[model samples]
Target: MPADPAVVDTDCCIVGGGPAGMMAGLLLARAGVRVVVLEKHGDFLRDFRGDTVHPSTMQAMADLGLLDDFLKLPHTEVRALSGQVGDEVVHLADFNGLKTAAPFIALMPQWDFLDFLADAARRYPTFDLRMNARAEGVIERDGRVAGVRAATPDGQMEVRARLVIAADGRRSLLRDAAGLPVEDLGAPIDVLWMRLSRRPADDPEAPLGRASAGRMFVTIPREGYYQCGYVAAKGGFEVIKAAGIEAFRRDVAQAAPMLADRVGELASFDDVHLLTVAVDRLTRWSKPGLLCIGDAAHAMSPVGGVGINLAVQDAVAAANILHDAFALDDAALDERALAVQRRRLPPTKAMQSLQVLIQNRLIGAALSGRPLKAPAVMKLFERFPRLRRIPARVLGLGFRLERVTSPDAFSG
Candidate 1:
């Protein structure tokens, strides 16, 4: 059947050119499916977002043959992840032994990561990259998704596809149009981020670690500089700004003294930006002929550094399932094709729930100086060698397909 006169047709039309959307497009396009990516921003790289790609994502990138390219970019390997419980710093390395080939976390700017994916997508003839295109609403027919209506500079245009993927971040226009329920797990604090010039003593190989004094602080290594972010109490940005730059510098210096020295060189407040961390989980991820990936489906809080890695995992899982369904001549345009959601939702929901429980219930109370200690829980984490392996395998990389299919299947 020919597409409507007012519509352009493709095998897959992906909304948003972020990591998940781009990855899905690349995977489908490689499988000889016609794919189009619609992005609202003219450029791919955006700032003030999650950037750490965990070991699992790195493993996925390696499978895609993009590992070397990623490593060539300015990045740091996080040898250890630490958490501050009261005045004590507990290293997480003991929780789970690093099982991934790339055991360390790669700290790179998200803009650079997206740019790399975009460049890779350009190599495939089956992929079409469309920028500055905003998806105003989805085109539905008989209670099923058919296509999307987008606003371009030229005017409104309709795009028809066998599959419509929503990867447009937390506040997705497509998800809203589909009437999906989004649950926001509010954060107790926000972050003020700044790019600090690298100190002569600073080592790109091993950047200074994250520290939390009732709030979190991290120094992520980026190209030629370091991305330093500080977690502030709710409504704390105004207080920091009102304290003046000098006072703010003093406070940062007191928290992470080494970072303070570097921050002192900052010329102005314009160098710093604020970001709010809110956890969002979608009630439904798919309907007939449509699916949502990445932040659109499940937006995890940054507490465990799982957001981007999980987004990449979602992309890989979607690609794998779609590749199989399309090959089997299954109706890729129906809810059955959304079976990937069945496979994805379980783990995504479980992890997101765990994050909320830990960050809000446990960590939140502890950060308030309440001296909330769960020694039994901590001892369990320390004693069980498998506890760390579970998270490392689950979050640091992709889900264990075989184990997820049958938990006891791995026993024999």
Candidate 2:
């Protein structure tokens, strides 16, 4: 017979150790609320994760007094964003124009950022992080979520909490188990991600986008390599593979001529990882005793690379909205959960709408193999250099950025 599941009781239990879960755990625990965070993976080293930490996120770090230390980590900063179309390099957004502590977007490995947040949360005795804990489903009692059932390395465990938070990614088992309805905004492209060695003579810009007739490529600079993305039509990986690695290499070289010499580094299809783009969000983000945040509540496209920042924003808003109920030992948290959804829904919808717009307009056209040229908007950036701040503000700060207002019990 199987052993009895080990039971852990806390004020709040969060599933998934991604940005949303970690930031929420850190903020709530700092407010003297007992919290438990479950991460399915033993470590935070995943390559498919987004790495852009925009100004809004850094502002929250600065509010928590961790900005200086966080910036010390190895990262590449992009002060401006630019794209090349048919031999014309047109500047898009300028992060340097934004007024924030960290004016540029910092590209650091997602694992490093997660580790840093975990370290900060560890300082508070109220925080409990369980690695290798995969949440199977929610623990429902009396028609409301009571906790979570998880499989850990040791054995099956049951975490009982006053409230359960599903911060899991887009394919959240918890959200599925809870039976929340999703609205699909639709995405027309899939991205093939791979790493190419960076040469000293390569473009110094941290991120550069390239477009040609029927092809699009984006390169994000890292320490010794570039994290590259080759965009193709949705559900098209099979076709790409059937064309063989040689043809694939030619396509990539055609998209970004600068990487022509290094195309051989791809070696085989195994070097490329496929990311099926999705743009979706839940209609209702909460039920009686549970709340969903981050990708669990909304899945974004790779357009502006704003997923991480948006998730972080959701975490902050959640912590601010629900910290009091958890700290004060109030068991009635249903209404507060709905309030979080209400407060975050606007920005979530706005960003997703913007992503869908770009996907349908810019990305769809390029993927169709049609002759592409710089859009008229490119001329506005050139004509008025200060206009770059518009995209910069929307991308860096988001439509509605949340501030870290949760009281810190350790502030004494």
State which candidate has the highest TM-score.
Answer: 2
For this target, which candidate reaches the highest lDDT against the unseen true structure?
Answer: 2
- Clashing pairs for predicted structure model 1, backbone only: 56-396, 56-397
TM-score of each: 0.84, 0.98
Model 1: residue 139 alpha-carbon error in angstroms: 1.7
In angstroms, the error of model 2 at 405 is 0.4
Off by over 4 Å in 1: 1-6, 84-87, 94-99, 200-213, 266-268, 324-332, 370-395, 398-412
Question: What tens digits encode model 2's per-residue C-alpha lDDT throughout 263-343?
Answer: 999989999999999999999998878999999999999999999999999999999999888644334578888889899
* Model 1 RMSD in angstroms: 5.7
Candidate 2: residue 207 lDDT (0-100)? 85
RMSD of each: 5.7, 1.2
Model 2: colliding residue pairs: 214-369
Output the lDDT of residue 241, model 1: 91
